[model samples]
Structure formats: C-alpha cells, structure tokens
Target: MNAPAASSHLLPAVAPRPVPQVLLDALSARFGPKQYSVAQAVREQHGRDESSFDVPPPVAVVFAESTEDVADAVRLAAAHAVPVIPFGSGSSLEGHLLAVQGGISLDVSRMNRLLRLDADDLTVTVQPGLTRKQLNEQIKDSGLFFPIDPGADASLGGMVATRASGTNAVRYGTMRENVLALEVVTASGETLRTGTRARKSSAGYDLTRLIVGSEGTLAVVTEVTLRLYPLPEAVSAAVCSFPSIEAAVRTTIQTIQMGVPIARCELIDVNTVRMVNRHSNLTLPESPMLLMEFHGSPTGVAEQAGTVQEIAADHGGKGFEWATTPEERTRLWTARHNAYFAAVQSRPGCRAVATDTCVPISRLADCLLDSVQEADASGIPYFLVGHVGDGNFHFGYLIDPNSAEERATAEALSDALVARALALEGTCTGEHGIGLHKMGFLVDEAGAGGVEMMRTLKRALDPLNILNPGKIFVL
Candidate 1:
C-alpha cells in the first residue's frame, strides 16, 4: 500500500526548528532539569498518539508536576510565541497530541492527586493526571464509581479534553454529562475556573462545555470535578450468537426501543469474534454476537435479561451464556476492551485505520450494513465492533502503515462510511473529537457558518493562537 497524495486535509507539513535558547533557559530554570527536556527520545515520545497520522515531534517536553507548573509553562510559551500541547496518557486515537507546528509538549501525568471525595454528594474533585481505573479503585471502598470507562485507563484530563465516552455511556453518559466543573490554564497562562460542585447551574457562558471537547485547541485543563454513581447491587453478563449481522443489529434496536435498560450492549461481527478467540483464548461460536450486561436490583436485572433474551430469540439468537460471577464478568469485558489489540495483532506489522460513525437507532441497520458491505468488498482485513445500544460502532481497517495503497484503501473505506453516516443524519465522529484526522469532516458536519462561528470563538478566547495550533481548524 502507498500513502495518499498530500492535501490540506492533514496538518500542513512544517519543518522542525530548534527552540530558542532564551525560552529554553527560562523554562529549564522554572521547571528544573528533571522536568524539562530537549532530548530527541522525549520529544519523539510526546509527538505521536494512538492515531495513524505521521507528524514531527515537538522541540521539547515538560513533565509538569502541578497546576502552577502548567500555568508557568503556558505563560512562558505565550511570551515566546511557542506552541504548547498538553499530554496525558497518549491513548487518544485522533492525533490530538501531535505537534504539527513545532513547540513544546507539557506532560501532566505527574499531577496525580485526589483532592476531594464527597461520597455524600456523589462527586469527586481531582488533579488531571489521575487515570480512570485509579480513581475507581480509590473510591471502590465507598461503594461509588466513576463510570466513564474508555478502556485505556486514560487520564481524567485527557478524557475531559476529548469529551470521551465508552461502553457504559449508554447508561451513564459521556464526559459532557459527568464533568461538573474544571480548572483551566488559558492561552496567556491565567487560571480560570468554570462551573462548581453544584449539580446544575445557569451560570453565565457554560465555559466548561466549550472547553470539554476543545482538544487542547483553546486551553489546557488542570483539574476536573466529576459525578459518581453508587455501585449497582446486581450485575450479570451474557453473550448471544446470531445467524447474521442484521439479526444482531435488529436485536439491539428492538432492545433499545423496548426500553430494556441494559447497561452495556455491544455488537461484534464474526470476523471480530475470530480475532478475539485467537487473542483472548475464548472458545465460542464464530458468528455475529452481542455481549450484554444488566445492572439493577436482582429481580430487575433478571427481568432485563429475560426481556433481551426474548428479543434475541425472535432474531435467531442462540448459545446464550450468562457470566454470573465477578471474575467471569471481568474476563468477558476485558476481552471486549482488548478488541482493538486483537484486531491489530491478527495481522503482523499492521496498523488500524479505525472509523467511528453514530446514527439514529432507526437508521443504524442501514448505515452499518452498508459499511460492512463496503469494507468486505475492499478486500482489506478488518474487524467490526460497536456500542449498538447507543447507535455507535467502529470498523477497524488493518493495513501496513508504510504502504500508501493500503492507507488509501482504508481511508477511502472510512470516507465512504462517514458519507453514509452523514446522509443518514448521523455524526462523523461519536466520541473522538475533531483532531488532525477529521478536520475536513467538521465543515461538512457543521456548515460553513457554524464552523466560522467556532473559529470566531477560538479567536476571541486565544487571540495569539499559540495554544495547540494547527488543530480543529487552521485559523
């Protein structure tokens, strides 16, 4: 496979230049030698993300230890007109951390601290560096859990920055719904706090939302206040195999329409099942499958499972197996979360060109069927998995990263899928924000007028355009 022709759709090719000596001296003095680095290895590590876009690394990396450190780093970068990009777990799949225009990468993974935990209010405040799994482990004794599990143990700040959601999003909602307030460091390095611990507010401009999905294009997030939920009293997992993809999708549609209240309803095509079987050492039917979980009181969970089982049987679902123990449930979901790795490892030296398109439940069957057909026809090795309960799914195209033809074929398939999703009044991206990969799709999703309004807001907030330049849009 060969790479596609260069276009404005990607970050414009920019030559890397050395960081100014004066700015380097100042940053080194402020952060100390332990925190600041101009080493090639450090720069290279900070420049890339989990996405497929190839970009040059930043000139320097700063491992910030506190909110004051972030403020100072941004302030110094602003004074020198250097681009500053925030770094978290680097698990983002949209090239959000790519240093398209060379400058510095400010790492916040060291600011891991749990500031406050209010079990009474069902809320917690913490530094941005804490990962989701760590947060849950800390609060598990209280019988409370944070539900935004993106499957990567990703940083809370990174999750907030991407406005991410995962398996539980169908029941618990995304970061936009869970995050109540934020402490941010602006373009000029001034501290700004948006919202509060209050559940809801009519306060002013709703800056928290504006910054939530900005992808570091507007400001750097330092702390996040999150909403938590009590652990469910009853939980159970089940997997059902279907005769065909449509039958599986129909089961999901009908389940949602019937109001089953399933906590997690995932769809895995036959090809994906094969990969998981190989990667996770599972022996089950090699057919289209739906992995589901029910949460509530014992009777309620039983009732929900009964309702879904009936719907699945109507669609020719069989081999219903329930994971009634904690260990069993964890093993099932861990395999599901490892689907991406399984798909990639299925083909040696292959990278995943993944697509996430969400449609209304009414149109899911059409959109997903067409996409699966297109991917199959492309003759590219691929896998399909979806959070079908919320009408969102992914198609992972496995291709040789250095082969332009393979890249082009994968991208063409992704473009066709996005077009189909848009035609059906769906979104181009469900969770991943508009980073370097999908900037072109933004204008199509949000009309020219709408995009212009976004640019205007960007300018109003960061007049210097020194904050994560060459992202979202090329202002």
Candidate 2:
C-alpha cells in the first residue's frame, strides 16, 4: 500500500506503572524463581531495543522454554490486566521490545529447538527462539536453506513479528510471503493455530498474515512453519560501480523492468562504500555501487551475469567484480550485511537514526536521489544503502544521542523523506514494522477506517489489552 504522509512525531511519554506484588508472587510460584526475574538490570536490559525510543523495562522477565510457558505468562498477565511484551534477539531497529505500559517480558529465547524438518516437503517447524543463522546451520546438510535474511542474525519469531525482508527479498520475497503457518498465544492465553503445511489454503481469514506483522500486539508467536528453498546449483556474485546514485538506481530500475531474475541487488552509496571498506578490511573503490548475486545452473548464472553487466555498462557502470569461490561469495555478502555497523562506527560515539522508505520501481530514481540530496544538505554524518531492485532504501543519519537538536534534525530529515516517498505512492516503512517509532505514520498509511477496523479486531481478540500495549497503535 502507498503510505500516506507520516503525521505523527515521537511517541508520547508514558508513565511507568508498578507491577502488582500478588501477580509477581504468583509468577514466581508458577515458574520457579530461576525462570522469572525482577532485578533492575534485567528489566532495564529488556526495556530498550536497537532504536532510539526509550521506555522503562518490564517489571519482570520470564524465560519461557516451551509454548505452554508462553501461554501461562499471557494468562497471568491478563489476570492482572498488565501488558506482555515478547523478547527475541533484541536487534530490532524499531522499539518493538520496549515495555511502554510496564508489564512482564515473556522471553522465548530458551525455546530454540528445530521441531520438524521435512526435506521432501521443503518445510520446517521451529520453536520461536532460534536465530536464522542457527536454523540455516542445522539445515545446511539437507540441501535447503531459509532465504529471508534481515542482515542481522535475527530470531525467526522477531523476524515474523516485524515482517522483515532483507537483501534476498528481490528474489525470495519477505516473511509475509515465506511464512507458512504460526502457533500463537492470544491475549487470553489460548493456543491458536493458523494455516497448514500445504502450499495454498482458502481455510479462512488469513490469521497467519494477520499475526505475522502485528508487532506482538495481537498475539505472541510460539512456533513458526517456514518455506525453504533448495540450495542453488550454481551461485555467482558481482559488484558494479556507477558514477552517481541516480545512475545506480536507474540501472536497478531498468534491470527489474527487463525482468532479470537477480537474487540480490543492493545499492551502497559512496559514503557507505568508504565505511564498508574500512570496516570490512577491503579496499573497494569509493563510488556508488551495486553488489548483486545470481543463483541457477552454471550456464544460467553466466547468462544472467552477462545480461546485467550489459545493463550496468549502459549506465556508465565500471568494474564488474565477480566472486567465483564460496569463500569469496561469503566475504562479499558479509561486507554488505555489515553495512549498518560500518555506518555506525564511521562516526565515533554517534547513534544512527535511519530512514526506511520504499517507492514504486518506476519512481525509485527520483525518490532516492531526492532523499540523498536532502541528507547531504542537512550536513548530518550519514550513510546510504538500498535494496534497489525492490525500490527500498535506507539512510543512516549519525547524531549525538544526547543532543536534542541533533536528534530533532535527524527526525525531521526522516519525516521529510517519508513525506516525499508517500507523495510518490510509496510506503513510509517497507521492511521495518511500525513499533513505537512509526505509530503515528500508521494512521496515514492506514486510513481512519482501516485503523478502526484493526482496532475492532484487536478488541475482539484482546479485550484486556494485555499483549504489547502501546505498540502499533494507542489503545
């Protein structure tokens, strides 16, 4: 959907609430003292995320080792009318982990088990705590792999909660497309199963999709069934340098328009290239560049690379670097994945306020170039990178976290970029789900009617508002 202009600012400050002693005692009794913690440090650690939004930590943290544990935590939270926030790897760029309403953090990281792996069916069922990397490692011998990579080794549960997509999304699609089924715990602690192992289903309301991107506001996902892909017969990686951001983006648009089955097409601006060079210990040319990957038979990969090389040359692209060996391929993509940290370390002690705007493929050039120009004009230390094949990109604006003026400047630039993207019929956030930071923008993206309908569903499923309250929308 084309997101409307972002209208909301930062989340309104919420006062902290005390956890009822009786509820805490009950929790301790139910799950032993070791499974639950109310220590100050633990609560503080669970309260923040990779984002800048700050809120007090949950009054307690419960380590859930099984689906029944999750259900029980939710049931207890509901009984006390307290909020329940699900915790994963804590790598979320938005404040999806913040305990805004003061409740218990039901951490599922302990439930990291690969329950079922059906190689013939190309499907796998896993408990919520397993990270994508771990899952890939365990399944590597099966000749299959999970393709949705959000750069960070994020947990599957967290990825589902945010509806994450990564560099591979140009070909593999996002979590919204890849997740086959879900086991979720409702606000009232009911275990609800959505979808089946079958590839297609007209079973009912697509509750799987509904809970996939709910940001843990609707239900806490306990288990996930994922679609897997066979390891490609042949893989090739390439890097092409362009004269300018516009040229690189134009090349991307034309490649997609020509229906090239490029697996990964990423745009790294000159500044980001410089950062990656320093961070990754590779001396790549400092210019706007596109790093890409192709998967197929040897002949197919060669044909695809030749086609993209011609397209790149037409746009004045230089230096078509290819990685032939497995080690080379890993090094190349690892550098690309570390772009975020590279951008962060570029400015010592500066926190990054990033933008996530995606425009239609046709308008990608205009939208990207305009946003880059704005970031340049702001004089904020920033880095740019994009999944250009899909018309999605990001700008990491580095600023002093303590300086309110700098923070506001970065936010203003982000807001302006979102406004421009919306005007171009794009979305305010393409991959990063709306947590605390983009709650206001949700209204613009989803009209009053759409949001009200969502509210109606939330009320129907969670009458007590116990699941991740004050997240996607105010209740």
Candidate 3:
C-alpha cells in the first residue's frame, strides 16, 4: 500500500485542479438519476474546513441522505480508484475534511435526523448528520441529555468519529465512553453495524471502538447509537481565579489528586483571559482561572462543590462565582466553548494554530511548564487551555496566515509539543483523532512496530487504498 501519486490534473493554470470525469461517472451510476448534480457549487462548498492549510477541492460532493447512499458512494469511489472523504458540519480544526487526495466529498449533512430516543433505556440512535445542539433541542423535554459536549454544535457522528471531548469530558468522559454503537460503511462499500444496546460488552474485538475513532479512514459513520444519561438532578458551576499559571496548574493537579468528581475542570491562562474578555464581550478580569462544574443529586453536588472549593483555597485560588441558574451556567460554558475562536479573534485576521498533547496526571505540572517554556522560546503568540482533569491541554498559536515565516515558527512549536508529550510517555493526541494532521507525528509516537500493525489493518480493510488515501502512514 503506497501513497497515491499527486494527481497530474492539478496543473497550475486557468483551469487548475481538474475534477476526474471517472469519479463523476461513478457518482452518477451509484446515485441513480437526477438527484446528484455535477455543479461547481457543490465542489466549491465541500473544499475545506476551519484548518489552517490549503488543498485541492473535492472533484464532486454527494449529499448522502441514508446509510444506503453512503454505502453506494463508497462503492463508487472504490471502483474508480477515487478517494472518499466523509464530511459532516465542516467544523474540524485539523484539515480532517480537506480533500488532500482529490475525490468525491461525501457530505452527510442531508442525513440529519433523530431515529430513536428510548428514555427509559437512557439511549438514543441518530443519523450521523444531527448536530449536538440539534439533538438536545429534540430531546429537551425528555429529561435525558447527551453529555459529550465538544463546544461547537458539531454533528454527533462527526464528534464520535473524531473521538471529541470538551468542557464536560472531565466528568462524563469522551466519545469513547459515551458512544455505544455505530453503523458504518467500510471502504469496499460494505455496511456493518457494531455494538449492542447492552450497558457493557466483553464481546470479541471491540469493532465499535475501531470505527468510532477511525476518522472516516476505515469507514464512513452513517448512524450512531449513544449511551445517554438521566438529566442530572442538579448542575452548578463556579469560576476560580489564580494568580499565576503554576498556581492554576497546581490547583488543577491537587483537585484531581483529591478525586473531587468535578464534572468540568479547565485551565484558562491569563493570556486567554484577555482574549475571552474581548471575544466573549464580557469584562471578566484578566487572570488565570479554573472554570468548573458539578453534576449529581442536589446535596451530592453541593458536597462535591465544597470539596473543590477547599482544595483550590489550599493552592492560592480565588474568584468564586457560582453559576447556579441555567442561564448562568450556559453563559459560563459558552465562554469556554468559544475559547478557541476567542484566542484567534484576539489577533484580528489571524488563524488559530492548535496542538493537543496529553500527559499522565502525575506529569501534568511538568508538561504544562515545558509547554509554556517551549512556546515562549519559540516566541509564538499563544493561549493555553485544557481538560486539565485528564491532563490533556491545548496550546493554540495565533499566526498571520499570510506570513510564511510566522507560520513555520508556529508549526515548529507544535512539533516540539508533540515530541515533548511523547517523551513524557503520553499520547501525541488524546481526544482529537489522528487525522491527516497528526499522522506523521503518530508514526513517531506509535513507533515502527505499531505503525506496521496499522498498515496491516489498512491493507486488510482497504486493499485498493481508495478510502482516505495517504492518511496515517507513508505506506
């Protein structure tokens, strides 16, 4: 399995990056008559996402409306040696949606629909296209909620595919813990469903997990069955201010060390505070803060809240603003969710370059210090935030996209961060899956034997190399 050669059709001319007619024909054959149009608008719309890079636009974009459509599209792609790129809400930050290899961009947006909500069982089945916000909207009156909130109202399928985690992951866990089943269309146009509704399974080979984080490389997720929860009896949040980054990190480490069960524990540096204040349109004082949340029976939440307050006090922390009202809690998370954009927005016209690294809980303090040091040494204007409870942090570098040197400097810092995480015996990626952006570093992190096994699985599943070609490996 070798990487596909760069398409010669991508000549730098007036009609640059010509779409392959063979792929267009395949789409028409698989999709039946006049439903799919070969219009330029479709191709332009599916070109790229929020990533800080550029690439060729997909040759065509098929609006997949059902699992059958996804399977057919994959078959068409396989037959023509065309790469298949699955797309959801186009919210990916890592170029996961970019058509690096020219092919049909399978847009799953049209498939958005809620199929089931078994409240008594505390589970839900949904089409991959339904956004998180959309799902909650449909189930708001049902007294059940999906807790894997990845900030953006990103598609549930997209979130699961990326193995995303956000503000609530500290208490609720990532998509890895919330997702129960998946209906997938494999590389060869074969459709299969994995995972049962059972609370837990010791079943053979954990296929559900394999597809959950595959990033559409192994399969296109058309449907997802998720583990839901009874709406918590009570939810409350407070923001605690710290004088220094070390103080903030120390508070976080100690809180987790004490096992406080805080549902959302995050570290926002003073630098990010300025950005949040401006971008959130609020006048929060410029300082390092630990934003937190608790979920349980009212009395239990209260006890957990008191435990956290005591722990933070020992670490020189202050600024306790309890967001007890629903509106207050919404406002708090809204600020946190927009942290990425806030960092980018601070520097007008600049792009946010983010790198994710997760270290062992015991090594979090050292990892934080090293990240700040390396980032400072590189002299990139950056903001730091994290799911500190899980020792996963993100360093977002703001760069002027037009300046090549500045971009290179940011990329160098990013590479250093991944190396540092690997050196600390942690993963280069914790939540965000190893999409194309992390593939090269994943090899370094995964080592030779690990990558070889990955290649073996790639060959076993996608022998033609038609599904997301050149991803996760050079081979």
Candidate 1 local Cα displacement, residue 393, angstroms? 0.8
Error of 1 at 222 (Å): 0.6
Q: Write the per-residue lDDT of candidate 1 for residues 47-93, one digit (tens) a residue.
A: 88878888889988999998899999999998888889999999998
What's the number of clashes in each of the models? 8, 0, 0
> Each model's TM-score?
0.97, 0.97, 0.93
Predicted candidate 3 versus true structure: per-residue lDDT over 265-383, tens digit per residue: 88888888888888878777688888899999999999999988887888788878899889998787665788888888788899877778889988888888877887777777899
Against the true structure, candidate 2 has what lDDT? 0.89
The number of residue pairs in model 3 that clash at the backbone is 0
Better of 2 and 3 by TM-score: 2
| Candidate 3 wrongly placed segments (more than 4 Å) | 1-22, 29-41
Model 1 alpha-carbon drift over 4 Å, by segment: 1-9, 13-18
lDDT string for model 2 (1-475, tens) is 2223464547767765567999999899999977999999988988887787757678999999999999998998888898899999998887889888889999999999999999999999999899999999999999999999888999999999999998999999999999999999999999989999999998779999999889999999999999999999999998889999888988899999999999999999999889989998988889999999999999999999999999999999999889978898888776689899998998888888876988999999888887888889888889888888899998888999998988888888888888888879998899887887777677777878888898899999999887888888886
lDDT of each: 0.89, 0.89, 0.80
The candidate, 1 or 3, that scores higher on TM-score is: 1
Higher lDDT: candidate 2 or 3? 2
TM-score of 2: 0.97
